[model samples]
Target: MPIPTSNGHASRVQIQEPRTRSPLPPSSSPIAFKEQQGRPPPAAQQTIAGKLSRNLFKGILFSQLTLISLLVIVLTIRGLILASSHHFHPKKWYPPLLASVAVSGVASLAWQCIFIYNPPRAVKATFWLTPILTCSVGILLVLIGSAVDAGIGAVFVLFAITQSLYGCWITPRLEYTDKILSLSTAFPPARTREVVSLSILVSVVYSGFLVTGIGGATSTRTNLDLLFVSVILISLAWTMQVLKNVQQVAISRARYVNFAHGEDMDAWGAFRVTVKHLIGSICIGSTLVPIIVLIRGSIRSVNLMSGSSDEVMYSGADCFSTIANKLITYGNRCGFVHVGTYDKGFVEASSDTWKKLRSTVGLEKLIDSDLTSSLCFLSAVSVGAVSSLTAGIWVLLIHKDYALEVTLYAFIIGYFVGRVALAWIQACVLAYYVAYSEDPQSMRFDGTIPNRIQRLQLLSARRDNRELEVGRDRDDTDNC
Candidate 1:
């Protein structure tokens, strides 16, 4: 048949029978078909088909309790076995333990002096209170751990002890700091409760890992070796999660401190965001772990191959390890900066952090201040040492046969608890640094920005203006 066209030319129209459809090749599976369709595989589809419901708080509680239970059982069994097999001598360990306590106290005092030297009057109390709280919590936890038998009751008693101590002592002091820092203006009751709850959850997880590690150390079973590995992995996972939460809290706190409107994001909401970005954050954190491990491994291999018993080899390795550790730590601090880049993609946040750290007048030094990190460590160490000493004395007087085991347990538990207790304070310090970096003028030092930061801001502004002028002048000349 022919159809007439608009140009007066006749065009032929042909019709043909429809061809049969060919089936997919035998080798092509359903998965392949889905892939061709840009869809997920059936298994994956089914995996996520159910309603996405994860109660993080409940999960945290369950995991913490379960881990604590396992740890207590293992420790209890180990203690029983040790008591039956070996005799403990309190006099043998007493001198070294006491010496350790003395050294820790001296070191803590020295570090505190470095931290508080010529510090602003406003933050002086904050710095002072941190060590005090750390010591108090550490001592209290050790006392509880030493007094109570390893059981479910022990867990409850520990929590009750912590709650009573925090409420009676720490909370009031923290409240005073809140008033000093005007934190109430930023943190409503709901927000404060969320922060406190999350902090407690993190503390529970940290304490569980610590207890598990200590318990595992007393056993030499193959099963415990496996369990130790599991504990390490789980601990790392929880640590990463806690660090991410800290970043979110830091950002929120910074916003509140700056009087930003609509900054009242709930803790659950922040946690959800953290979960959404968990993979990316883990990838960022994990990259450093492997590199550090590989470097240390390589150094060890070189030492073995060289067979050089020289001090130079050891010193070099130590130096490299320190550098690697600092690099990793700096990377961690950068995570908080990434948090400050609100709603930005992970790549962009990482890039921005890199740029800032590389900047000549940037906040790298301020954010990675030795005062913040060292003080926390020293505080924990000091408290742990003192707890060890106390446990030794108690064992000497009461449980003379179980002196070594109890003292070791107290020292390890106390140190971990102390560190976890101060984690919130560290978050706040990071938040302050972030706020200052974002807007120096917004930070309140006695109700006004600090003179040094204000001057730095002015200098930065002027430098930016000059760069703009230079760029514009070059553009005008190029046009001519």
Candidate 2:
């Protein structure tokens, strides 16, 4: 066999014993790059081979996201007390609310215990119960909201009803979604509370925004309070999205290293790399989703306030906007996978992810993807509904005045728990898609989900074939 000469030359040279070994190239040598990367020096005393960590953990620095998150936290807190002072009743609201949160926390902890043991069945159960939770919550809230004249309750009821309807719609086609979620359980990340801690922080940030923004809203124009409220809300919106993407990116990086390179990267290490290098990429990557949402919401608000003179025009706008938002959301899910795995910017990652999905999995995988997202979302809210029921009833019987506070706190705690549990599944599943896209052969971690996309593709093709045959038969009958 040819051997790498101790000298930095291509020509073959005789292997020598350790005592007779030649020196390696100095850092300043012309052949340093080639020599460092080339075949190892002859069997002499060579330094131990480098670890994967040396190469795998690297990226250009981007810290803007870190700054933004800090800024939002400060602003949201300031806005919270200044804007919502009137709504907060310390004497009537404090004790019951604290008790409600404690009860909800215990319930939330119990719920998470199920997830810790058998994840799939827990998720499956949650998925099935989403419709029930939504419908019940929607009906009860609508009745109580009407009785108590609570606009916020009505808003939640509307959202709950919509979710209930979607849960019903997605029920029949849930097999693949179940499989998709089940498949993601194959990856068991190390115990890392970074994501959970951030989720709680985010929940707190959201509470501040919800209270302060609602309190600050006014019919009057050109007011500093309203402007400050708008800015806080917007910042909160963007900050949450960016932080979510950050978690996904961190999870992807860890899973990608585990899958693609066979490295054992823990969540903390991956998150550190994310904070050190990929934070800015995540911020830029996640910006468009919030922007699209803001635009759609603004248009809807304008149309509603103006009494919707051109209903058809506004309807068309809604249709297009919804389509665009859904498309971008899907694209972001896939695209962020690329960003996490490769040293690419958001747009390039998105373009590449789309092309890879088209060439390999096609449109059918998107169906399964949609199913997974919908089910996860339903499962999340359903958890919140159950938590609210657990805590709110007890508080309601005694401190009837603080029903809203109890429900809100309980639901938020439960939702935060759900987010902590489910976000990893979503992030890992996307990483799986990206892994399959990058290299299909190495996905032996799970056999069932590897062929799932292919199965979907075949089913799609067969359905199309049947449709074509039916069309041809109809044409023949018409001719006869």
Candidate 1 per-residue lDDT over residues 206-264, each given as its tens digit:
44444444434434435665565456445544553444344444434333323322223
Worst 10 residues of 2 by lDDT: 9-18
Question: Worst lDDT window (10 residues) for model 1?
Answer: 8-17
The CA root-mean-square deviation of candidate 2, after full C-alpha superposition on the true structure, stands at 13.6
Of the candidates shown, which would achieve the greatest TM-score relative to the real structure?
2
Pairs of colliding residues, candidate 1: none
> Model 2, stretches more than 4 Å misplaced?
1-88, 93-112, 143-175, 193-234, 290-331, 361-370, 386-417, 443-446, 469-480
TM-score of every model versus the real structure: 0.45, 0.63
Candidate 2: clashing residue pairs, number: 0
Please report, in order, the local distance difference test score of every candidate based on alpha carbons. Answer: 0.42, 0.52
Q: What are the per-residue Cα lDDT tens digits for candidate 2 across 211-300?
A: 333332321123764564455445544554556677777677555545444444566655655665555557666665446545655765
Error of 2 at 49 (Å): 38
